[model samples]
Target: MNSNSLNNKALHVNLREADMQFFRYNCGGWKAAATLSECYQPDRCGPRRFSFVGGGGKTSAIFKMAEELSDLAVLSRPGAEKRKVLIAPTTKMYLPRDGCVLLSPRLCEVREALAVEPYVVIGQRAALPASAFEPKIEGLPSSFLEEAAMHADVVLAEADGARHMPAKAPAEHEPVLFPGTTDVAAVMGLDCLYRPVREVCHRPELVCRLLGVSPEHLLTPEEAARLLMSEKGQRKDVGTGQEFYVLLNKADGPEQLCLAGEVAKNLESMGCRHIAASSLSPAEG
Candidate 1:
């Protein structure tokens, strides 16, 4: 009925096949999915596995979710020990053993975060560079997907665009050949910041009132440049629902908080879902 209950149900459903297969192969006994679900219920002592993709706010969200679930369970029963929920981050970084693992290229950042406290550590193969050969398949790795399905109670993957830059003006100018006047002039530029549609547009807390067009749907860089140089506007309807967000990433010291607050209010007014915000400062006590 509630979000937590829904999540719990999803967890139970996901674990069914894995638990049954594990028992059938190792214990040499037939175990039903329902039995395994009961064994792994919220109040049980069994370890719960939650696998998640790295990057974005997913890690933070999962951490918050774990804390909430634990608190809810404890509140429901005054004298009960909270169930341990393992939070794992899958990247090309160091791997975690018991608590969580970082599995990709950004190893340093993950290591620093983990070193602040004791946690399970494990490492995986480094991520392949973007310049590597194209995949034979269109989607994600089958092995990765199966592992997520079988081993994880909850898997949160960070979805992002291939290449994105914050909204800002260009720092340099390029020389262009002109037909007449024997003179060269610098061109005015428009700075636009790009972000994943789901992260930006769909987020109620960000206060994004308008939908965004994807890079794939937009005109080519050269075409856009030509239009701008000729003082002609190029408007192409990429249709709605491409899933990306854009914003001016720059704001003054006081303006940042003001903007954030405004966005929050707008989101609330628009009936947006799952909105959250946090501020991190090293100088804070």
Candidate 2:
């Protein structure tokens, strides 16, 4: 993992693909081999469109998902052909990390690449305002994303930013999703549980609003469930026909995993059908 991968929110993760099986960190990177379950055979079929929102590990989730779907190109069974996946962040994102190829904006070049590569990541170059040149890429416009979606078998897009918080409440303009998105996975970190909103949330005010609390609010597991399920949170702007999923991330230890299970139960009671728990951060000593 890069020095900044874990420090930066929803931007990068350390993942490597090998041996027909993907190797990721114990947290979800290049050391363990766990089910990249993707909440239900995310690899079922293609022309599949997936988008990620929420904070915590959204970026890591996308890369992990890419590791899962790109393998479709390697299947040697009958009718298995080179599969293509396009990772286009509809909101601002860092440039492509390891384990992915960049998608050239040129149509011919893209076509050529698709003829060989299994997956590619696409984003518009973004110029940061404060710093003197940083490597960054903002999301493509909806129209352009739609145009590019035509060539890929699977399209994975990041539709939100959380500045690395494990949880967040979306402002009115947040989470700019692709129009064709078929599934949306919302992630929150268990590490945020019991932490103060001002300390762990990307938009504390919005989260406070949703939780009916103050800046110093310590998020309980129940509050975490409420925030994850609230329309005013990461679920904002999610349209009909799009399946919504909740991922409780960074559940690192026995206690956190136990707490994540509790949150998952509450989410189920609140009518969320798709829920998963994971420790998606690199293991720390």
Instruction: Identify the runs in model 1 with alpha carbons over 4 angstroms from their true place.
Output: 1-99, 102-123, 129-154, 161-255, 281-285
Q: What are the lDDT scores of the predictions, listed in order?
A: 0.26, 0.68
| Candidate whose lDDT is highest | 2
State the TM-score for model 1. 0.32
For candidate 1, write residues 1-285 as lDDT tens digits. Answer: 111111111221111222121111112222322221121233433333332211122223333344444443433676754433323333322211123433321334333433332222222433553333321101134344334323322222222211222111111121111111111111111122123333322221121222224433332233222222221111111113211111111222344434433443443343322122222111100
Best TM-score goes to which candidate? Answer: 2
Clashing pairs in 2: 9-164, 24-29, 24-30, 24-31, 25-29, 25-30
lDDT of residue 244 for candidate 2: 84
